[model samples]
Target: MKFSLFITGSPTSTKACHSALDFALALMRGGDHSLAGVFFYEDATYIANQFAMPPRDECHIGQEWADFATQYEIPLYVCIAAAIRRGIVNDSEAKRYELDTSNLAKPYQLEGLGTLISLSSESDRIVRFR
Candidate 1:
């Protein structure tokens, strides 16, 4: 089976993001499932911000998600409008907006909601983490 995921919770604010990762990994380990994409929307866009700094004791969920995406060959898509509203930006966007910095992490691409729609169309299942 192939699946796409939609995440709407901040990693630090709730366990939903982590739980989704766990579930996706388990599916991969089963050898019969694959993740097509992970769409981060609303507050979940924080997970794609490279500039996020959690306490030393806490795990860096942004990096964790980036690594997972790389390891599993899953595309990580962050809603461009949502992310920009939350201060997440890539180099191009930063330049366009004349920002001093860009914080979008690798493996997390900035896209429109259309990407989510496309994922939903291509996937066998679409899971929401919220």
Candidate 2:
């Protein structure tokens, strides 16, 4: 089976991100399931913020997500509107907005809700974490 993940909780303020990661790991290890994609919406868009710096003793959830996506070749999509509203922008967006820097991390693409719909349509199920 193929599964898509929809996450909508703040990475720093909630366990949703970690829980999603755990679930994804399990799915991959199961050998019978695959991930179609991961959509970060609402507050979850913060997980793509490249400038985030958690304390040394804390887990860098953003980096963990990035690494997982890189290792598994899983598509990570962040809602463009939500990301921009939260001050998370890619290089092009930063240039378009005349911002000095871009803070969107790699492995996470800024996309619209249509991408999520597409992922959902292509997956057997959508597991939401919030």
Candidate 3:
């Protein structure tokens, strides 16, 4: 089965992000299931912010997500509007917005709701974490 994940929680304030990661890991370990993609929306868009720095003792959820996506070749999609509202932007977005720097983390792409729609349509199921 193919699954798509829709995450809408703040990585710093909620366990939803971590829970979603755990779920994804478990799904991959099953070997029978595959992930079509991961969509980070609402507060979850913060996970794509490259400038976010957690305490040294804390887990860097963004980095964790990045590593997972890179290893599994899973696409990480962040809502462009939500991400921009949270000050997360890639080089192109920054250039377009005339920002001095871009803070969008690697392995995460900024996309619109259309991307989510497409992912959902292509997946057998969509698991939401909020």
lDDT by residue for model 1 over 1-130, one digit each (tens)?
Answer: 8899999998888887898888878887899888889999999998887878888898887888888888888899999999999999999999999999898989899999999999999999999999
TM-score of each: 0.95, 0.98, 0.98
In model 1, state the lDDT of residue 110. Answer: 98
Residue-wise C-alpha lDDT for candidate 3, range 1-130, written one tens digit per residue: 9999999999989988999999999999999999999999999999998888999898999999999999999999999999999899999999999999999989999999999999999999999999
Q: How do the residues 10-88 of candidate 2 rate in per-residue lDDT, one tens digit apiece?
A: 9988999999999999999889999999999999999999889999898999999999999999999999999999999
lDDT score for candidate 2 against the true structure: 0.96
Error of 1 at 74 (Å): 0.8
Q: How far is candidate 2 from the true structure (C-alpha RMSD, Å)?
A: 0.6
Candidate 2 regions exceeding 4 Å error are none
Q: What is the C-alpha local distance difference test score of each model? A: 0.90, 0.96, 0.96
lDDT of 3: 0.96
